[model samples]
Target: MKALFIGGTGIISSAITRQLSETDGCELYLLNRGNRNESLPANVKVLQADINDESQVAKLIEDLSFDVVADFIAFRPEQLERDYRLFHGKTKQFIFISSASAYQKPLSDYRVTESTPLANPYWEYSRNKIACEEYLIKQYREQGFPITIVRPSHTYDERSIPLGVHGSKGSWQVARRMLANKPVIIHGDGTSLWTMTHNRDFAKGFIGLMGNIHAIGEAVQITSDETVTWNQIYAAIADALGVKLQAVHVSSEFLAACSKEDYTGGLIGDKANSVVFDNAKLKRLVPDFVASTRFDQGVKQTVAHVLAHPECQTEDPEFDIWCDKVIDALQGAIASVKGR
Candidate 1:
């Protein structure tokens, strides 16, 4: 099989790229901005160009085509439209990476399947992804444009830990708070169920559908079947870091409302609600697909990787300060109401 990945060197797609380039019996080409110095296998061809510049990409890949072309970075309808124009007849499959967050917010059911109605108003990011998926499905139905949509939820690589209450600086800040024995936030008493998939495991199900004809015109969510509460998720990370779990509980809505960026979408829209995915569709399509990594196991690996690498220990003083303020204000509010 011949495959092409646009924006391949990301947290998720990098795993797929490595897997394909190493042992899929497939010729792989990774097109990216050439900014990162990730050590990829030499056999994998790198297309160095800005994909946003259509003319530049066209001139670069003059006559190239593939059995599968997956775009990992496209988040909007316009981007998908560009892909429809570029790879319409050039590939056997065009996979659009969508988000499980695009699933209906305040879900009607805790269980989500591929057919779960897509609607997310809290997060513009999720809405944009919903729009993109809609556009692709439209193209598939009207023009027979071989499209496959893969929705991923909270998938993590070795580089970062997946956290629902992370600050603007990303998961690293949460890790730092853990190491420092500071009070890390876990939204809404830490009881919402969420699933996190390891990148390598996610790659297996994803790669299985790369050249699959049955997957065309289909939407499938690839995620771990194992579900954990927000409390357990934090405890696993604390366990991995060999530290006492110091979690401060806060409402997701309050967390979002307090922040200038208003993470209501990521927090309230997505992670605040419990979600258990039915991967029966994924399994029916790819019989061998199994998310083998347990949270207790996967999180330890992530924490170890980040701890050993000093470069990954980047700090977020601003977020740290904000967390302290939120904690203090909550404490003060409680005390003042009692006339303390």
Candidate 2:
């Protein structure tokens, strides 16, 4: 079968392309902005086009068609709409990559199925993804556009890092800090439960679901079955690195008091005790889906990747600023409380 993958330059999509090329009887075509094509397979065809531009995308699709279209980076509704306009009738199936954040629930719920309500309209990223999913489902039911949605949990490849106090990056950052023998920074008690999935496993499961007719019009949560707390995650990383887990725990009340002036920093305190998602539906859909890499194993792989490729280790400036803000808030709270 012929497959056209959008945003093929990313780490996740690159793995998918490699897997598809190795599989017999599968033809792969990558449609990217043409920025990073060095690691792509020689046998895989490349199409240079901006997916955000409707005219260029439509023109590209005028002559080319595929049995399956896997979109790895459809973050905006406009992008999804452009995809629908370009390949709605031409492609046999559309597989959209969604996030577990699309589900509005705590992590401790034990199981959040496809039936979970999506994030509220105020969350820009999750809301946009849900809107795209809703649009695709509507098209499939009314206009017969074959569509499947896959919601992956925190996916970490060897190249990823935890950046700051929040987000997937933040989690990785905490792990890195622990690995570095630095104190693990905890905003509030550090009892929040979360899960991480290796990108290669995620990509494999995603590809397996591509042409499965029964998967159409369904949202499958792709994640590891293991659930862990923030403290446990830090301890695991430290243990893997052969280091001690030294943590500086801050109270939630202190963080709340500091948040009066710095809301973003204080918000991290609340997330400390939150449970994010449950991936039971994924297990049921792909009963054979087994996560080969554990969190510690994944962390070691990530550390190796960072050590080998120094360029990928540079921290994002925005994350640095956010971290500074949180630190400042914490310091101010300590001083204020001491003065009282």
Could you say which candidate leads in TM-score? 1
lDDT of 1 by residue, 1-340 (tens): 9888998888989888888877847999988888873677788899988788898888777798889999999988999998888888889999999999999987999999988889988999999999998899899999989999999999999888888876666789988888889999888989889999999999999998988888999999999999999999999999999999998999988889898755788888898999999999999999999999999899899989998988777788888888899999999999999999
- Alpha-carbon lDDT of model 2: 0.70
Show the lowest summed lDDT stretch of 10 residues, model 2. 261-270
What digit string (tens of lDDT, one per residue) describes model 2 on residues 1-340?
Answer: 9999988767567677878888889888888888988877788988888778778877777888888998998898878877888898888889998876666633335456777767543245666788888888888899999998988766777776532144323344554555666565565676756676777788767877877777878888776766777677667666656789876666655544543333232233223335444555665666677878778778777766766776665544454354456666667878999995
lDDT of each: 0.90, 0.70
Candidate 1: TM-score? 0.98
Off by over 4 Å in 2: 105-110, 162-181, 240-242, 250-280, 315-340
What clash pairs does model 1 have?
A: none
Span of ten consecutive residues with least summed lDDT in model 1: 34-43
